[model samples]
Target: MSTLNRISTPLTELTGVEHPIVQTGMGWVAGPRLVTATAEAGALGILASATMSLRELEDAITEVKSRTDKPFGVNLRADAADAEQRVNLLTKYEVKVASFALAPKPELISRLKEHGAVVIPSIGSVRHAEKVAAWGADAVLIQGGEGGGHTGAIPTSLLLPTVAAAVDIPVIAAGGFFDGRGLAAALAYGAVGIGMGTRFLLTSDSAVPEEIKRRYLEFGLDGTVVTAKADGMPHRLLRTEFVQGLEGAGKLAQLLPTLRRTVQFKNMAGQSWLELARDGLAMKRSSGRSWNQMMLAANTPMLLKAGLVDGDTEAGMLASGQVVGVIDELPSCRELVDRIVDEAVVQLKAAAATVRSA
Candidate 1:
């Protein structure tokens, strides 16, 4: 099937985007280049800002705007010290959507919505989805445990339906989604669209290191593990030797190393210590994590940056989805999105034919 073939679904119109697929806001992974490309290719491309400085975030927004005229969103930590700055940038830029990494405050949602920006927060449970929908969020992205980074315990098969049945607003199913079959299945479950993180991270447009991306392709479906060691919350990541070591490092010994690592990262990134601490505290409070847990929470992104940017797999963590093993090659954003849509259309039509004959 031609990759351009698309599924006729509400997602195409609801988000005012061309496709029913979304490239989720992956911290440090999804940047201006990838976001703009995904948006231009007809999917919601969200700029991941949780790992960026306020200035870096604004520059990224500008970068994406420079690349594509299509509608795109910025993913922000709703509880950041500079959240106001990020929100202001979004409003000033007239960003079409604002996706929260964590459940943002109602006022934050209202503030962004007041500026004509649609609010969509990724949810891990039925309650989370329902609560946000009731709060007047434009939509919710329901992610399963199989998703990368910080994720909830619910499976997509169970969580998607639960959230869809409970909320009146749109829900975009995420986690374990790689191709059209997943999209068709999500739509069948009443989801307007499918959100993807690992799938996009493995794409040609993704700036992740070539070797690291290759490692993702080599792993199998069972290659991932969910661990709380990175942050206070559970996160999905590839089970590498370093990850195993980190996991075994236990909570006590991890603090000093993590702090040292964070300080080094700040230096490398040229961030002030005060700014780092401010962002860290904001992240901790937002996630309901303790101060110590917040300090530990800095490990995951640092690990990811180590592997993705520094070519040091042993020095960092590699957060990836379970779908990483199933992905064998890196295709351009257009090619990847088109292929999945076309494949889904063919699959749905074939199923329809079977029903008709029956």
Candidate 2:
């Protein structure tokens, strides 16, 4: 049952985990239960904090700690108004790793490092990987265009080696990664490990409702679509009726619903109208998003919550990678990790034999 012998890379050494697999922090999907289970299973588990309030995040970190003594990470929105407070919380809790979706300020990275926490940021391009490395990031997670949620246009096969060669730090490959074959392929691409969001979300340990999980399993390789209609950013999502409707609808046609969801998200996240406006303004400045795009951004969290947390596929958005179509069953974290490791070892040995014969 122990499959640790299959891999030993800088990622496993840096994170102090037995395996180099990382369960990414998907908004509203990655929670304390799933994170604790992944950590216990010997992979790095990152708790998604973007959807949680400051108090909620604190409680979640404590809960995960209570559940497992193994090391784990917390993913943060570096652009959040309370980013500083969240960093302090990580320092206070003595969390092992701090991950960011957007590049954090150099000072923030320094602060985390000072507090004895490893800093890893998810990047979509080679330049971004280089920038974070120069800013002293401990590691970088690179996600290709095939990743779920907001993604870029580059495929992992192309992006991985580009970024891996661009940075001196360890690179973790993500997007379209589901099984042991992917693990072997990523390693061949010079990545130290692989990060998986959709694969982990479909696991038995994930808190997503069973009905929604079943819905996800129904998708084929072509069951997903990349649309900018969701948040004015290219988002990879399941090709549900709701998504098709969004694709066909005009901007004006979608405006009213987007605004309503905006208000709902504002309330759910416990942000005042003024605070939401300020965050929107910050996003606009940082990302160079137009007014329309910024307005649409408000709809993302609520829509995700509806589908992932409430099991309302008709009205909610399911952020997923293209790999969902290929995954057919839900395995517990331990079983899934062990299976991948064992399979990877077999594949590597077979390849070595081929090399010898050649």
Candidate 3:
């Protein structure tokens, strides 16, 4: 009845999921419906709480529970003003895993683990991975430069093996993973699972508009650009006219819209100016970003909302992985998960045969 036996790994055992694949929490893209579908399809589904208010997050969690009776994870902002409240919400709902885009505080990690939730943080470097493993993170998801949104310079092939060797905990690979061949490759590299964002975003269950999804499908390997102009960080995005304009325009020209989006995000997040400032200060302290970069950081959510939620490609940009070029069709979660698992089985068996012949 379950296809999980096809590929067993630490990730599947820890999360009690049938597969070792993960649907990453992309802001505005990973909502209740998509998360629920991913859960039902046997991969770990992570709800993106960075784009949600406290109440909205709770409701979304409850809705997912109503839809599926499987384990799932919630991705949270470690520096969020309501981080404690959100942790309490997860405890209240008995969510299985708690994920963070940034490294959570040591005390917070302790608190979650004590409450019977597994804590996994997304890291970009080996040192960061080692830091979290030392701090008692249950696992680490490593996303390389080819990943969507904010990313680092190291590619997955290099980053995965380096982090896997440095840390004793389970490693989940992200960036440029789309199918079963990638999964087999990750396992060979010592990763326990693969986390995917752009791949999952193209799924039929995704909340992104069909037209925006179509726009994403038109991309080739060269269709993506990693530019710091979007949010003062290295963000991989589809080469849209809007992003091109942002790249050409000076920082001064981008300031007004950035400020306006900050206000809009504040209202949407139900956070006051003082609260927003405090969060920014905390982010600045933790990340060591410049004041200018911190100011620009506020634009990320609003811009993502425009393209992902409103489907306004001209007004906002699409965050995508370099692997977007090879993906063509929109498959339902079940179809995608099953096909990947089946293909992985074939590939693994073929490799085993080659070993025997050798």
Score every model by TM-score: 0.94, 0.98, 0.98
Model 1, 226-286: lDDT tens per residue? 9887776788888999888867886678878888877876875577889878877777656
Kindly list the per-residue Cα lDDT of model 2 for residues 228-321, writing each as its tens digit: 9988999999999999998899988988998898888888888999988887887787688999998888889998999999999999989999
Q: In candidate 1, how many Å is residue 58 off?
A: 1.1
Worst 10 residues of 2 by lDDT: 1-10
lDDT value, residue 269 of candidate 3: 89
Clashing pairs in 3: none
Candidate 1: list runs displaced more than 4 Å. 1-4, 268-275
Q: Where does the lowest 10-residue lDDT sum fall in candidate 1? A: 1-10
**236 Cα displacement, candidate 1 (Å):** 1.0
What is the C-alpha lDDT profile of model 3 across 1-358, one tens digit per residue? 4455458899999888889999999999999999999999999999999999999999999999999999999999998778999999998998999999999989989999988999999999988999999999999999989899899999999999999999999999999999999999999999999999999999999989999999999999999999999888899999999999999989889889999999999999889899999989988988889999998899899999999999998889899999999999999988888888888888889999999999
> Candidates 1 and 2: which is better by TM-score?
2
